[model samples]
Target: MSTESVQGGGNDPAIEVTPEAAEEALSLLEGEELDTDEAGLRLFVQQGGCAGLSYGMRFDTEPEPDDLVVEHHGLRVFVDPASRNYIGGSKLDYESGLQAAGFHVENPNVVSECGCGESFRT
Candidate 1:
């Protein structure tokens, strides 16, 4: 595993990922052909979903200066500091089955989630 310090800007806060969560994210990326050479996951939070906040995840090659970069199991995960408050203690896991296969976040700050699981409210 590797670790990188993030440069701060604006109101960018600090975000941390647990070893278990990082490992799980890396395992899920294995065997998949990523479009980027960096081989890492980028996490972000957006607005306008049914629950007011939506989570986004993708494989990324570049990270913004204000992004918190965490590495585990040869994978790099990036998250903006502003989104940290909502997901600070969240656990990321890969779930696969007949219905769905994706990265799920167990965010403690999430008070309500939409039926489709695309968004949440704190």
Candidate 2:
């Protein structure tokens, strides 16, 4: 994966999205029939997981006022400023296997994760 920095949000570099992940996100967005120009994938970190932090993603029609928007492979990604600190330099990847197919994050800031791998602590 390649790394690139985004301006105007904070010191941390914006999270990177793999080509496969970008394509998958685009596919999902298309399935919802959302206007590509007006829609984006929002990535955020929320509290309350076993490890104190849990990642979240969803299709959003509009970004927050202070969101850092990055376009990858023609797909728009919105990362909130607060989550940027914990997810900077991370890579978003989609993995497919016989047993599971899902999006996975390789976050450099993650110091630990729960046994079930549902939550993380930085």
Best by lDDT: 2
**Residue 79 local lDDT, model 2:** 89
Error of 1 at 87 (Å): 1.5
Per-prediction TM-score, please?
Answer: 0.69, 0.90
- Which pairs clash (backbone N, Cα, C closer than 3 Å) in model 2? none
Considering only N, C-alpha and C atoms within 3 Å, which residue pairs clash in candidate 1?
none
**Residue-level error in angstroms, candidate 1, position 32:** 8.0
Worst 10 residues of 2 by lDDT: 1-10
lDDT of each: 0.68, 0.84
**Could you say which candidate leads in TM-score?**
2
Candidate 2, residues 5-119, lDDT tens digits: the string is: 3535666577778899988998999999987777988988999678999999999997788888877777778889889888877888899999999999899999999998989
Global lDDT of model 2: 0.84
For residue 92, give model 1's deviation from the true position in Å.
Answer: 1.3
- Candidate 1 — which residues are off by over 4 angstroms? 1-39
